[model samples]
Target: MEYTLSPSVTIINNRQVLVSSSSPSPANDRRRRRRRRRSNGILHFPFVFSGLSLRFRSRAVVVAGAGSYGGYGSGGGSYCEFSCLNTPIEPATPAGRYLSSVLLNERKLFHDAVAETLEKLVKEVDEAYARKALTVDSSEAALHRRIAELKQQECKTSVEDVMYMLIFYKFSELRVHLVPPLSKCIYNNRLEILPSKDWELESIHSFEILEMIKEYLTFVIGWRSDFSVTESWATTKIKQANLCHIYTTSILFGYFLKSTTLRHQLEMSLADPIDDIIMNAYICRRKNLVFGHTHNKIPTSPFDGKRERENLVSYLTGFTSDSLAKCAQPNSKEALNLITKYSFALFGDVGSDKMISTSFATLKRLVLEAVAFGSFLWDSEEYVKTVYNLEEIN
Candidate 1:
């Protein structure tokens, strides 16, 4: 049987989507309400009243506090990063729920606990380095020292929450700068978030790092060959569950872009015309190369004879925050060590059954936010390491 929904309910039907918060502010995602077009006093959305089941959230929305910081952009200067720290945030929006890990915290009035929590997680994030830095070679030793000093105003490095808040704030700023006009696709009058100028502009990525990305963005927009590369953008109906995978993949793509860009810049500074950036990029993406592994074999197909569950990590590596540092280049092995253990896991899984029809415009904003996120992470990785000794600066 076919179903009909208003634009709002239609958008919410996409199931189990995930983070990104590419809009002007995390606050903009705070409360999403689907307009129920009343038809004879009954909520008209068939999805809501249908016999098919839907998940309901039990816990009150609670987000961590992002305290003030002087170095970076105001670290959630308002104290509440997602919604005043301790109130319901977007119970209706499936996409915002994937950030549960980043935003989930107790109902506390102050953000001090979050800082403390992040401080403790620093060692956990760098556990491998902490355990092996001294025993390893000079290179790993150097990376440990570098991560020891990675901070902004000491507080950012000391408490990653400040940095996290800064990234959130930064993306909000970009969303304003990169507003999208209504799509020109007559059939796809549905709104998206990137500008009309960029709709068919080929690429939004920087030239310095374009080759390295090599369809890495397949996770976000799908294979370039699958659609008109410069003539038209495709639309997909993403289930909320699948949305989490896409958002996380986009973030990973951002991280990869930054790491490659830095590696390129570093090579340029060396005054040598190295021709293996993409080679190093491929080396960096190898799952086996994680944590100083010397394995250099190309990863087998995501599923080699075995079912997807057997190759789950390899399969899902492209879908979650677990692959942040997996793109370590052969030369700069410790490129991502400073922010190694960081993750973007946030919010509860609330909309497992919903799905959203993602437009090219929405995809555009998501890409913009991701690149911005990667840039900030790279900056923090450099800043935090610029100073050593991993002590909390409270």
Candidate 2:
């Protein structure tokens, strides 16, 4: 039926029949008067009012249309109607509600908590380490003594602790001028935190270390290839441990990158050599440690695996604040530590410790040497990926 809403307004159903006349009846006139009183009066457009439904729910006008027609009437007049919705509807999705909540928080309650949290964590670790180191004089001295003691005692060590001790021990020979030693570089000497460009870019002349690393990289490139090498059993064991250190360090570095603002800033500031340093670190730390124990042969030693889960946490807790401070800076120490623990947990589940205390002790020294050599590419004069070039920083 054709419903003629007003003189200009008309709505046709499937059957061609007039529902209302052009001249208004008393009831229609009253409806028009009531609509005219409302601010949401019907628009005078034939196409708009044809199949459209405008709902006035809670005094607000809402326009809803099914379809539109091609042309207007003979008089070139178009009209629209604003109908009332008896029942108000809630939105189907929580997106609108969420947006409102976000808006509210943004206006009054939003606060960034990362920086403060990181600072707190770093302080805690530093204090703990400071306290712990008192037994052996300085932290570095104590660390070195501990390394020596561990070697003598035949005790196992965490990859991180072993890495730290090895790096500290090699600082002098590595030709890197670490200001205030480990203490200066770790906390705040952002300007000279890492080794100079020359120390990093030097070509690795250590063929034995290079050969081991190269062989491992080759194996990694062809990971699908059957794991068989013609090297001596001793060499094979060394390679396996080296591979584990590489994997462990790479994973840790990645975590550090994501966790800490300082590390991220360092990456941003010295883009070229910094990335190279991290990449080299990754390459150095690369071990055959896979995530899930899906393979036939385990990549890392049981000792390394145990260290990842059990000893690593204990080791970290000893200097947790310091390490966290280095990475998270003003925020996210607990968050980062939680992430580390979770990652370590995953590693523990997937890997087994095959490395003996002696083997574990020996590999750190090897890894230190390998890392120093491998990371030398960053010191090359020609390498120039830096923030100065991008004008991100002066």
Candidate 3:
């Protein structure tokens, strides 16, 4: 398929979402044309919208003019569509016109930007596996080969995808989910996502994971103009744009973890039932997903490696979110882009400087949801690619 990028269009989730008023203001029209503002791969909508989103995400991946992804089966129920959409899609304070604006060539920009960031990060990670490799190319090849040829067996996937998963393994080391006693019903007699008040934060990643987080903190957050990140990131007012950046990257982080964990499980599952004990041990739980008051609807973390595969498979077979279908598909490319780009729209104008001074406790839920969002995206992108051309299809 062939597509064109237009400076006049707003591309959300890889689909063009054109927003225009039925009528144009004579005063505004009379104004002289000016150069469009530079965009940082984030779009800003100035007017009121019921939340104008151009992407569609349901229970499973659907590849139409949009795309559909096949979900994995976990012997469990489905999650609420876009349960990961923790915030509204409006600007923080609103500033910029939609037309006459362009994204910073996110497709090519993403790869180059990540390569530059990873250049500084690769040194801190344990490269005993790569024989002291320092650049992304050498380290990526060695790491991808290791995952593909585990236990003397082979699996096939793009080296780029594998590289992303491996790069993130060390850069961050945290995940979030709600504690047990997930109540399915509330005073309104409807299913609602539990608030951050009930969240449980865990930092039990491997020694390597923690070290990577440290390296990233120093490289990325150690010198920010907005706020500071100490050994413990204290509760302070933070820039919405920065939070949006973190939000987008966290999704990629979890998505990579989910993908790597699933591939690793495929290799280990065939080796020995005894090996399962260590690899498949419980990780963390994601508070995203809607349950039918059933005991098994809760989803296991992708890191768990024991049930995410099964959970994803079940979604393919028959899991669904009817009324919410258009709003979710946590496992699809559209959903991935939808959630990732959401950061650009959440506060102020596109890349607005306004800060979301909300309590740290309240924002934690959104942060965790972003990670869980990526995990599901991996499942969607992973399974959908088997039948669809896949690879973000941009």
TM-score against native, each model: 0.37, 0.16, 0.31
lDDT of 1 at 351: 46
* TM match of model 3 to true structure: 0.31
| Residue lDDT tens for model 2, 200-224 | 3123223332333332222221111
In TM-score terms, which candidate is top? 1
User: Taking the tens digit of each residue's C-alpha lDDT, what string does model 1 give over 1-394?
Assistant: 1111111221224422222222122332232122122323321112111221112234343333322111112223121122222221122212122222344543231234333444444555566446455746765676665555452223333334333443433433333332211111112223233343332222434553443332333323432323444323445454444443443344545655555444433333333234345445443543222122322223233223342222212322232232333442111212222222222122135245555454444454554444545555544344333222233211
Per-residue lDDT tens digits for candidate 3, residues 1-394, read: 1111111235555744333221112332232112113333211222211122334332332211211111111224333222211222321111110100111223223333433323323322233334334433774776655643451121112222322222222222222222111111111211223344223322323333333333222222221123333312333344544544545544554554454444444443434445444343322112111111222122333344553343222222242223122322234443444454343333223344544333333334444455555554554344333322332433
Global Cα lDDT for candidate 1:
0.34
- Per-residue lDDT value at 291 in model 2: 14
lDDT per model vs. reference: 0.34, 0.26, 0.32
Worst 10 residues of 1 by lDDT: 1-10
